[model samples]
Target: MLKRTRKHIKQLKRSITQSLNTPGRPTLPQDELNIIERIRKAAAANNQNNITRTQAYFNFYQNHPEVHWALLAHLVSRNAGWNMTDLKGEYLPKLLTDQEQVDFFAFLERGNWLIFQDAYPQLLLYEESKKQKRPLFHLLDPLNISKFMKPFWENMWSNERKEELTIALIINEQQYIEKRVIHNTHYKNKVLDTIMFKLQDVLDFNHILIPYTTPLQQKTKLVGGTVHHFSSVEDRITLGKGLYDLLFSVQSRLTQTVKWAETNPHTGSRKDYWPDLFNDVKESTPGQVHELKSSPCSLQVKASRIYSPSLPSVWKDWEHNKAEPGDWYPNKKMFHFVKQPIKQLSGDIEKTYCETIEELEMAAFTKNTFFHKK
Candidate 1:
């Protein structure tokens, strides 16, 4: 173990030395700088909100289908939008104070924004490389992408190891946010370490749902796994791999899920997939407790649709502070994250999601009633 630790320390020292000696933005040619500017503008324009980011990912995937990670990011971004709108949806407003909701939204928004800003440039640079018929990922350094990604992108350009590239991106982005958001003192106190965040585990809320239509039946179904511990980077990377496998490893799922995304433009509402259970419009008056109309056993909606607002309806575009500067590539240990075996995933979680909603409604209703009585 001591020998291994020494080796790791040696690797870390080499990585830091390489990073410190890396060239800065001044070295890039004027033409490459122009391309980088265009890429930055494009990323900024699309990074406005969940709606724009989700659509951008889909469009990128359509154009460059070889980048499997683009599609995975699209699907995952959809879930992030749904979670954002959920803050103003039927149940959460009852349970959280206005400030708490705002903090939670900020937490979600920062991570979403950071990932897109970090990743989208890499995507666009690859597109440029294709146009020029030469590898241009060296421009990634000027764009402020993680040094960890440049080599992966270079290797991908040469070898086209799509899955490995995807896993590398997962590690890079997760580490990108670790210091800037997850462990930051402010977010730790305000969002991550709070009871409300803890309640996510109890409620099984950290799920990345991929909505896809089955081929034979043409039925829309939810297939995803839950990440119980969001604070752990390893768990999040594992979740990304599982989701990627579920979407791409299965031929039927890959084709159909793409079809589903093509058909349903994400409106940041659960209604996009299960319109029977969720509505983007506000159906009930504010602060009024309504009886739960959805049945967990039969998965039926008997009454008015639960309010699930679209992204724009509840939240505005966030102008994020510049991401803290640094690369997250620590050592060769990160390669293990890319090589970890993909777990066999069972993509059936619809019933459990319904039950979670029911529980949330009950909790909100009880809180509302107790407050009124007091």
Candidate 2:
């Protein structure tokens, strides 16, 4: 009986090991796991933002006892080409009322949008000062485009929708005030030039309109398990073009400003060694021989006859041009220029993505399914 019981335990252990070793699901990296953890935690909370809504489905799967299996089954079916029609008699539909499902889906769509935004971080504007020599500030996102479009997204999934959704892209510029004093540590000039560098008020706030429209008159089905519905190929392409133009416009302005800052000539203090002839000659008496000293003041003692006006042009130039300021030079090394997007340009950014949704759909379907092959 002891041997039989041991054999039974071994068989159970083998089964468990086999289940654990099942393939298909790739192991997530530590960073991705951390992101997922944050997502799950945020979704589990009563209050969740537009970004955490997709994760709430998983939260429900883990916490909701009776509705868990129903949600899982529906997810599997949807993945296998079954639309929302497969949700019949599911506990998920019963527990989460119709309106709640709509709300959840809306947040899910917004969450996907947030993911795109996070992928392309905001641009960093670096201050070109010694004291404040770092990323000064970031522009955009103050307009809050995602939050602004939330109200218009209500009828996005509706079968009957009329007007085109309008979105705004705003650019707000900040200027340096030149307030903080910069001490010239490298310059050897006698005069200590302390320049103040500070940031000033914001200006040149402008906005552009982006209109989003769908070509489909019928109710479009949700794809890829997300709340985002399907639009026409032409419509998607036009939206892509508009976003590209908008982003390029903003980027061009930033690039031009940075180039100007880097290439523009600015007069600054620089140090250079000069002979202490002025103080040395004044202090030394004619009777005693003046010994050369190299302490606080660097000086070379010579016969009083060497100070004659008949000296070479080189010596005369050096003597006359001593303790002068530096000439104008480009301020290229002062600041760092990084061309990154502040806010994720609205809609599907095809540049960062592998292919457009239209291309993806075309690839998925057979030539006969849509129409004659091109």
Candidate 3:
């Protein structure tokens, strides 16, 4: 009887342990786990409030498991250069403060998991396709141009002012504006939830307000004057020059902004000689980007159809969109609602754009066709 009782107890224990083990928690690899632990430590050292950084990791790992170690390794690599001892005067107003930047570095490092979805180990790898493709400029009507260019611009700048200037100009030229139209949140905002006071300011600037809006009824209010969609194939000379002027300025100014990184010829690693992520007005004067690249007014919008098929009736709003607060800005996303391969136009300088709409169209597609926070 005693032997039989011991056997029963052992079997019962085995069954319980097996139930508990059921591939619990979908753990990352040991190396990946170690990286996450190090990131947590790094985040804490930068700030006691490493909550945001932690959550970003949690979210990434929850979904993508394949590159977890690669991502973690990628993140730890960024800690290689940051000089954290300096504070306000040391690193401020240029690259975030030592603490803020360190914290961000950690966060982004952990974000490697998401980034690893593409090029994992190299920064130079981005936009290789864009570099290979020699692109042409366009002055297609402002709204269409704005719609296409907005995401590209947003991807390249971090400052709200710079982004705003770019967006306003794009919209002004495109002659249309899109409000978030629906409420949504940025990643940081969602993690902080209601505790974030900045949420108010972000919402004011980022969210579109429409009290009557519902998922059932997608609605938006266009804040600015809407440019009529161009139907005329007649050369839109005024527009072509305007677009070229703005784009050329952006490219020139931006190039000047990032020039230091390219020319300084630093030794060591990226983090080691990271010449202040960008320069300031005081440290070095910004080169002028306002120069007209060509005979400004001579530029014309070359269209396939010289005579517009007659633009449809004008409306105050461009289109209704369903957007959320979680979406990131300084990033543009387009959803296709119209099925037609709609054609539009823009041009400038001596190039006269491409000879046919096919070339022009191809040029526009090729230009700056990459995205990320530059």
Candidate 4:
């Protein structure tokens, strides 16, 4: 009987230990776990509050079927020079309005992921074909163009940008295509015709080209080559000029901003640099931009006025501050304080303080005043 009891106790202990270990719980692969952790960190860095960040991560995970770690790594790579937090606080704000920032970031976070699935495979195919000296091209729309061009802008000061000759390459391709069509028609050219026929499949692709900027990089400079299609010559001209303008503007302004930020002893590493840009007001001295509004206290106060307790009442007697002390007295029918049941601790009596509307108003005003000063 004693041996049987001991055996039963051992079995119970084993079962309890197994249950505590959570044997039934599903486990994720190491790579997937790493991606999830990165996403969590990214969301936290981007959002203002913990609750918002947590909700955003859940929403992102639920919406995206799978995570592409490679694509994510590319976006956050040192070569890319993108800070995910800056997308919300700096980059997007330049491209979008205040109202559009939230939805745009959410869209960008997921949209890029979806695009990556389609893009990465094509990029791989292009890479392989390029080795055999085969022509491979891809079409670039507004979204992907920005992604492709961003890296070039990042290396603006480097010799790689000049050697890549992005604009010159596109011009060469355009001239080659036009000249070949005309030349083939001018003479009976079977070889050129056959080559063009073979390329016809991918000819319409909006091809983008990246440059080999770094030796340590695994990626190549020749990304995609293709004929760009436009509705009209005027539109094409406008877009071409626009592309050059965008590159030039970003290159000039970003170079200046970075130099200022890095060299200025007053500007700390943690300081935000975006607000200092695009002021367009040049200082009497060089390399200084005008400062915009530091804080949105005025805007906040203006917005709060609509819903504030201080707003005029529809009925004069029902105003927020019109309530009498008698109305809040014990057992009063008009208005009464419902006393919360208190638990005695160490035989001590504690005073319960009730907050008043006037006090709340004063507090809000004080907070606003403090914000305005900063």
Q: Please report the candidate that would top lDDT against the real structure.
A: 1
Task: State which candidate, 2 or 4, has the greater TM-score.
Answer: 4
Between prediction 3 and prediction 4, which has the larger TM-score? 4
Q: lDDT (CA) for every model shown?
A: 0.83, 0.23, 0.25, 0.26
State how far residue 276 of model 2 sits from its true place (Å). 65
> Compared with the true structure, what per-residue lDDT tens digits does model 4 show for residues 214-276?
234421211112224422222332333233333233344333322332332111111222222
What is the overall TM-score of model 2 with all chains considered together? 0.17
Residues 1-374, model 3: lDDT tens digits: 01224543344335434433435234456744554444334433332212222233323423443222222222222221121111111112132323444443333233322222111211111122134342111111110132233322233222222322222232222222122211123324332232221322232211111011112333211111111222111112223223323323444332332232233222212212222221112232222111122232232432112111100111111221222122122232221101112222222211221122223223223332332112
Q: Provide the lDDT at 365 for model 1.
A: 88
Off by over 4 Å in 4: 1-104, 136-241, 248-374
Give the Cα-based TM-score of candidate 3 against the true structure: 0.20
lDDT of 1 by residue, 53-168 (tens): 98999999999999999999999999999999999888888888899899999999999999999999899999999999999877777788877676667767876778768877
Evaluated against the true structure, the overall lDDT of model 2 is 0.23
RMSD of each: 4.2, 35.5, 25.4, 32.4
lDDT of 2 by residue, 105-209 (tens): 332223233322321121111111112433211111121122222222222213111111111111100001001101223221211121100000011000111
Candidate 2: residue 176 lDDT (0-100): 10
Q: lDDT, candidate 1, residue 264?
A: 98
Query: Candidate 2 vs candidate 4: which has greater lDDT?
Result: 4
